[model samples]
Target: MKSLQLLSFLLLSYIIIPANTDGGKKKEALESQSQHTRTKKDQQNFATKFRLYTDATKEDCQIFYNQLETLDKCSFNASLPLVIIVHGWSVDGILEGWIWKMAAALKSQRKQINVIVADWLVSAHQHYPIAVQNTRYIGQEIADFLEWLEESIQFSRSNAHLIGYSLGAHVSGFAGSFISGTNKIGRITGLDAAGPLFEGMSPTDRLSPDDANFVDAIHTFTKQHMGLSVGIKQPVAHFDFYPNGGTFQPGCHIMHVYNHIAEYGITGIAQTVKCAHERSVHLFIDSLLHNDKQSTAYWCNDIHTFNKGMCLSCRKNRCNTLGYNIREERLPKSRRLFLKTRARMPFKVYHYQFKIHFINEIPGKRIEPTFTMSLTGTKEDAKNLPITLAESINGNKTYSFLITLDTDIGEVIMIKLKWEGTAVWENLWDTVQIIMPWTKGTRRPGLIVKTIKVKAGETQQKATFCSQSIDNLHLYPAQEKTFVRCEDRFQGQNRK
Candidate 1:
C-alpha cells in the first residue's frame, strides 16, 4: 500500500509542474506582444526621423539633436500645415524634444500641421554675421523648394507658417521675406526679439523689418523691456512674452535656477516638444486649411504701459494705472520746457523731474556727453529734434535738463536717454522713463514728471521720445463688455 501511494504522488507532481511552466511561458509571450503593439502604434501615428548633413560637425548638442529625431511629427488629415522652425544663438539643434512636444500638442487638436525641424548649424559660436547669412541661405533654399512643391505636389505656401525662436526667429524673418512663391506666407512669430540693440536706433542699426514683407504678423519677447522705438510698427506682434519679467526665468535665485532646469533642461525640453507637436498638429492645420486670420494674443503689463497705444493688442487690455494712452486734445502744446507747474484742473495731475548728473570716481577726468533724437516714419522723413542743455561741468560735475511733455488723456509720456562718455567704465546710456508723481492727486496742476533709468549700458548719443497715442478708448468694451471682465481678469503681477 505504501509503494502504491508514493508512485501516485510522483505522478501528480509531474503533471502540475509542467502545467505551471507552460502557463508562465504564455504570460511572458503576451507581455512582449503588448510592448510591440504600443511601439508599432506610436510609429504609425507619428513619423520621427533624424537626418544629419554629410558635413555636419560634432558638438556638445549633438546628443540633443539625436534625441530630437525621436520626437513624433504629429499630423492631421495625413496632410498637415508646414512649420519651419529655426533655433536661437548658441543653441544646438539637439534639443528638439520641446519643439516636437509643442507640435504634437497642436496636432492632437487639428491634425493637419506638418513640422520641419531645421538644424541649420552644427556649432555654437560668436559668428553673428555668419549665423545671419546661414539662415538667409536656408530661407532661400526653402523658397526654391516651395516653388517646386507648388508645381509638382500642388502645395500652397500661403498656408505655411514660420516660427523662429530667438536668433532662429531673426533668421526666419530673413528667409521668409526673400522666398519667391505665392504670397501664402501669412505669419512670422518672433519669440522674444533679443538685444537692447533695437533701442532708439534706426533700421540701419540692425536688420530692418523690410527684409521680410511676407510676414503679416509678429510677436516679440524681450528680456529687459517690451516695445521699441523702431521695427515693424503696423500689425505689431501680439503682447510680447515677459515670462518672468524678461529675465532668463522668473522668481528668486533658487526658483530661477530651477526654471532653467525645467526650461532648458531635459525635462523642460520634453514638455516643450509636446507643446510644439500639439500646436503644430492641431491649431496650425485648422488655421492653414480653413484660412483663418485670427491668432492667439499675449501681452505684458509693462509693454502695454510702456507702448500705450503703439501696441494695438495692449491697448485692448484696459490697464490705465501704468501710464495709459494719450489723447492729442488733452496734451499741452509745449514749445516751453519746465520742471513743475502747480494748478487745479478737472483731470488728475502729477509732476516729476530727474536731474541729469555725472559723478566721476577718478580725481580729474573730463566726460562730455552728447545727445541726439531722430524720428523716421513713412509719413515723414527722419527729423532731428534738438535737446536743450541745462548745465555741464568738466570732471565730477552734475548737469540737469528739463524737457516738458504734457500728459495726453489716457497716455503717459515716455523718453529714451542715451549718453556717451570718454571713459572705459560700464553702465552709461541706459533707458529711462518719465515718472509722474501726480497720478494719485484728485485735482492738481500740470503733471510733474521725472526720468528714471531702467537699464545698465555704456552712454551713447541719443534719447528717444518713444511715446504712445490714445485715440480710441471704448473699442473692446463696445464689442463685449461682460466678457471683457471675465476674460481679462488679473491673475497676478506680470512684468518684463
Candidate 2:
C-alpha cells in the first residue's frame, strides 16, 4: 500500500517543467507548441518512469521502486553497486528488445548488484521527433533520482553505472551531467547512441566524455545503407569503438524478402536495421559472459590505417579490450579505436599485422595483386591465407595489412610469399603501360620479394623472412607449396 502511494507521488512529480515560462494557459500552450518547432533547449517534457529488476525473466528480486522510501524496502543493498539500464526511441519503450536481454545478462553476470531498467513508455510512444525531445526530460528525472539516492540512502554515485542504447545513451549522459557535485558517475556505456538530431548537439546536449569519469561507446551501424542509421558515427565518448568499420556488420545482410521474413518473423521484420545496431548490446553482453573469448581492438588513427598494419603497436595504453572487460586504465583518451568481431557469439579472433617490402621493382602504375602466404610459427603453421597487396608490389616502401588468424601460429619463424598465377604481366606491363600510355594488359605479373618483415599484433614481435637458396618459391610460377623455412633467413644485407 505504501509502495503504491509513493509511486503515485513520484509519477505526479515527473510532470513536464517548462524552463521558466509565462503563467497563462495561452502562453503555456504556445510554449509547448513552439518546443516541437524550435531547437533542442525548448523541450519541456520532464516526467519519466523507472522499473527495477534483479532476475533474468522476472521483476522477482522484489525491487520495484521509483520512490525514495520504497527503495529502502526494495530488494537492493545501498552498499552494493547500482547499474541503471536505459532504453531509447520506441513505441513500446522498455517493453521488449535490448533492455530485456541486457538486464538478464547483467543480472546473470553480477547477482549481487542492483539493476534498474528505466521505462518511460508514455513519452516514447509518440512519433520519432517527439520521442527525440523526450530524452532530455527522461535524463533529468533519472538524474534527480540519483541525487535523491545520494541524499536519502547515502548511495555512492561513483558506484553507479549507466548503460544506454541509442537515445537512451544521451539520456544516460544527461543523468550523469545533472547528478550534483564535481564527481561524476563511475562510467557510462553507450550502445550505439542515436545519430539523428543529437548529432551536432553540444556536450551538455548529448553523450559526451564529460558525462562520466570513463565513457565507452560502440558503433555497430553508423551510416545508412538501405534504411537510416539510427546510430551516429561520431566519437562522442572517451573510447569509441568502431567494429567492422562501424558501417556494415557481417551477418546482418539478408538479401531475400521472404527468407528475412521467415527467419525474423513478421513482427521482427525490422531486424534488417536493428540487428546491426543491436549487435553492440550483444557484444557487451558477450564480453561479460565469455571473458576467455574477450574481444581486442587496436589504437589507430582511423579504420583505414587500422586495416593496414601501420598502427598495430600497443604503446602507452594504446589497445583495449572490447565490452564489459574494457580497462580504461590501460587505454588512453583515443578519439576512435578500431576492431573486428565475428558474426555470432564467441566473437574473439587473433589479430596479425604483416609488413612486406618488395625489392625488385614492378614498374610504375599502381595495381593491387593477390598473393598467398604461409607462416610457420613456433607452435603451428598457417598456410594459404589469401593476402591482397595494398600498394603495387614494388620498391622499398613497406605495405601492410591487418588480417585475423583464427589459431595462434605462435612465434612466426618462417614466412613464404608467392603468387597464385604468374604475375608476369605486372613486371612487363607497369613499364610498358607508362610507355604505351593506353596499355590494356590485365594480368597481375610477378616480382622478386627479396625479404619480408612481419609484426605480430598480439605478441608485438617482429621477424624477417628471406628467399630460400636452393628452392626459391619465385622460380616455380604456378607450382604447389613453397618451403621457405626459418633456416632460409636471407638477411637484407645479401640482397642489397
Candidate 3:
C-alpha cells in the first residue's frame, strides 16, 4: 500500500512539476490551451530549432529554418556526415544536459562530422497529450529543414544519421516518411522510444524499420504499469536490442530512488523513474567511448532460452554489436537480440556458457549439490562465482548454464569447482547408510565429471576442460576439484 501511495505521489508530482525547475512558465503555457480544442495559432507556437556543433565550433551555433545565412555562419559542411540528435518530451521548455554531452561526444569521436541537436521543447513542454499530438508537426518541420538544406547547398540525405530518444524517435520516423524514395536518410537509431500512445500502433504511426535505410533500437525500460509501458515493448527497428531483458536494469532499484532523491532533492524523484529509460542513452555513449570494449548482443527467441546458455552461438548473423559499431544487416524480418550489461558506465561484460555432464556411481542415485566456481585465465582470475542449477543432477545428464564475469579474464585456462552439501541432506544420507547393510561397505554416493565444455560470447571461442587428475575425478560433498584446458571430445563419448 505504501508503494502504491508513493507511486501515486510521484506520478502527481511528475505532472505538476516539469523535469527541470522552469515549470512556472511551462505550466502557464499548458494551462492556456483550451481543454476541448487547440487553436492552429496555439499549435504553431511550438516551433522547432536546430543547433549545430562541429570541430571548429565546440559550442553550439543556432541554425534557423529556411535561413541559408545561418548555416554559413555555423560553418555547416555538406561534404561530411551529418548526425542529428533529437530528444523526447520535456515538461520544461529547455533541452536536457545530455543533449550537450552527446553533441560533445560526437564531435570528439569524429573530427569530420556535423552534429545537430533538434530542439522541440516548445511543443514538448505542453501537456503530454498535446505534446504527443505535436510530434507529426515537429517531424514535418524537420523534413522541411532537410529538404531546404538539399536544395540550397546540394546536400545529400544519404549522409544524414538521425539519433532520437523517446518521442523524438518517432519524430525521426515521421521525418523519414515525409522524405522517401531515392533520398532516404542513411540510418535511424531509436533510444528507448516512447510507448504511451504509440504502442500497438501501425508501422506508419511509430518508429519502424522503414523509417530509414537501416533502423535499430535499444530498449532499456519496458516494464508495464497500469497496462502501459514507459518504453515501446514491440520491435521498432531492424535490430531491437533488449539489454538485461528490457524490463528492469541492474542498478535502478527502489533503493536507488532514495539515492537520487538525496542527490537532486525533489527533482531526483523524476530521475528515479528515468534512470532505466535513460540507460539507452548511456549505452550508446559507452559504445562511442569504449571502441575496444564494445558489447556484443546475440539473437535469441526469448530471454528464457538465453538465460539457459542456449543462444550464445554467433553463426550466420546470430550476434552483433550493441550500439554505434553495430553491423547493418537488413533482413526481411526484424531481429531481436539480448545481452547483459553492468550497472555503470563501460557496461561491457564477458559472457560464457558452461556445459558439464555428471555421472552417478550408484544406480538411480541423484544429488542436489550447490556449486561455486573460480576461473583462471591468461589475463586475470575471477574468484568464487556462484553457479545456480534449475534442477537436481541426474546420472549421465548434461546441464548447461550461463555465467558472466565483469572483467575480461582473457582465455580461460583453468576452473576450480567446489561442492557444498546441505546439512539436512547429509544427515539423511547417514541414516540411510546405517539402514542398508549392503551400502555400509560400498563407496558413498559420488558424481564423476570428466570433462566440461565452454563457449565465449564476445570472441566466439570454444574450449574443452578435463579433470586435472583422472584418478581423483570423483566429486563428493564438501570437496573441491580443478579442471584445465585439454583436447577432448565431449559429444557421443561414454562417461567412465
Candidate 4:
C-alpha cells in the first residue's frame, strides 16, 4: 500500500509540473507534440515549428507542415483568410497566453480563418541576440512553408495577415520580404516588436512597412534601458500606434506586480517586469471584443501635445483605432499616432477637448488660474477633471486641455465649472507659491469668460458651454452649479 502510494505521488508530480515552462498551458497545441516535440530525437534536425489550424472544431485534424511533405495531410483551404501568429523568445516554444487569446478573438469575429501559429520555441530559447539571429532563419523556413502551400494547394498570400509579438514580429517581417511579388502578404500587426537586437537594424533584417502592403504596429514599451528597450520605438509600420506615450503603460505598476506574485509566487516577477511590454496584446484583444467602443488615437508630434488636447481633432485622416480591426486602407503613408487609455480591461476612454478663451477684468500679467470641472451625461457623470492650459495663455487666446473619461456617460448633458486661487498660477517654472496674500485692494484679479468651445472626440460632437452666472466671478474654487450639459445644442446647467 505504501509502495502504491509512492507511485501515485510520482504520477501526480509529473502531472502537476508543466512538461516545459509554457507547455500544456494551451488547450490544444498549434502543432501537437503528442505526435512529436520539435527538440525530440527526430526533430533535433528541424529548424522551425510550423503548424496550421484551419478549423478550430477539428482539433485532431492539425496540418503540420514539414519541408518534405508531398501535399498529403498538409493541405489547407485556400479560400479562408489566413492569420499567422508568431511568438517571441521562450525556453519551450509552446504557445503562451496571448497566442490562445488572440486566436480565440480572431475566430470569434470571423466565420473562417486559417490561423497558423508559428512555434519556434527551441530556436527561440537562446540569448537575446542569438535568438534574434535565429528569427531570420525561422522566417525563411516560414516563407518556404508558405511557398509550399501556394504551389501545392493554390494558397494565396494576399489573404494572409501575420500577427507577431516582440521578436516574432521580426520573423513575420522577414517572412514577408522572403515571399515576393503581387502575391505578397496583406497585413502584419507587430505587437510591441522586440527592441533590443532588431531595433535599429536594417529594414531587410527586421519588420518594415515595405514587407507588407499594410503594416500596423503597436508599441507599448520603448523606454530606453541603458542602450536597450523592450520594444522598438521607431515608426516601422505605415500606422504605428504608441498608446499612452508608448513607453511605460499605466497598469504596469506595483499592483500588477502584486497580482503576478499572487498568481505564480516569485516566478510571477517575469510577467511583472513585462507588464508594459505585454500590453500591446491586451490592447489588440480589447479592439476585437469591443468594436463599437473602439477608441481613436491621434496623429501627434509628441505625447505632451496629445495630452494637452491639441491632437484630438479628427481632421481628414488624423486618427485611427489601435487594434486588429483597424481600418486596413484609410490611414495613409506613416504616422506615429498617440492616444490616452484607461489602466484596466475594456480600456476605452472618451476623449474631450475643452477650448476656453479667457477674458480678463484686470490685465496686469494674466495669472492662469487652476480649475476643475465635471460633466453630467444622461445616464452618468464624471467628477472633477482638472482643466489646464495647453500652453501659456497669451492675451486672450483659447487654451485646450485634452481629457478622457473612462466610463460611458451617454450624451453629455451638463458641465460644472470651478476656479481656484487668487492669482492663477501659470507655470511650474513661473510660480513657486507656498502661500498667496488675498487679492490686494479692489484690483478684482479674476477672469471674464468669453467663449467655451468643447468637442467630444469619439462622436465628433460639438457644443459650446458658457457660464450664465456673473461672466467673471471671483476665482473661489467652487461654482454654484457643478454640472453643465446641453438640452438642445447649447443650453443646460445644474445648481446647488
Best by TM-score: 3
Give the alpha carbon lDDT tens digit for every residue of 228-278 in model 2. 356777788888999888875777764432565788685344555567778
Encode model 3's per-residue lDDT on 89-205: one tens digit a residue: 895577888887788878777889989999888888876656766777777777767877888998888788899999899889888877735668889999999887788888877
lDDT of every model, 2 decimals: 0.32, 0.69, 0.81, 0.70
lDDT of 1 by residue, 140-230 (tens): 4445444544554556766565666545555555555555543635455554332322334343222234433233222221212123211
lDDT of candidate model 3 versus the reference: 0.81
Query: What local lDDT score does residue 313 receive in model 1, on the 0 to 100 scale?
Result: 25
lDDT of 1 at 7: 29
Q: What's the true lDDT of residue 178 in model 4?
A: 75
TM-score of every candidate relative to the true structure = 0.36, 0.79, 0.89, 0.79
CA-RMSD of model 1: 25.2
lDDT of 2 at 175: 80
lDDT of 4 at 103: 77
Each prediction's number of clashing residue pairs? 65, 4, 0, 8
Which candidate number would show the highest lDDT if scored against the true structure? 3
Model 4 gets an lDDT of 0.70
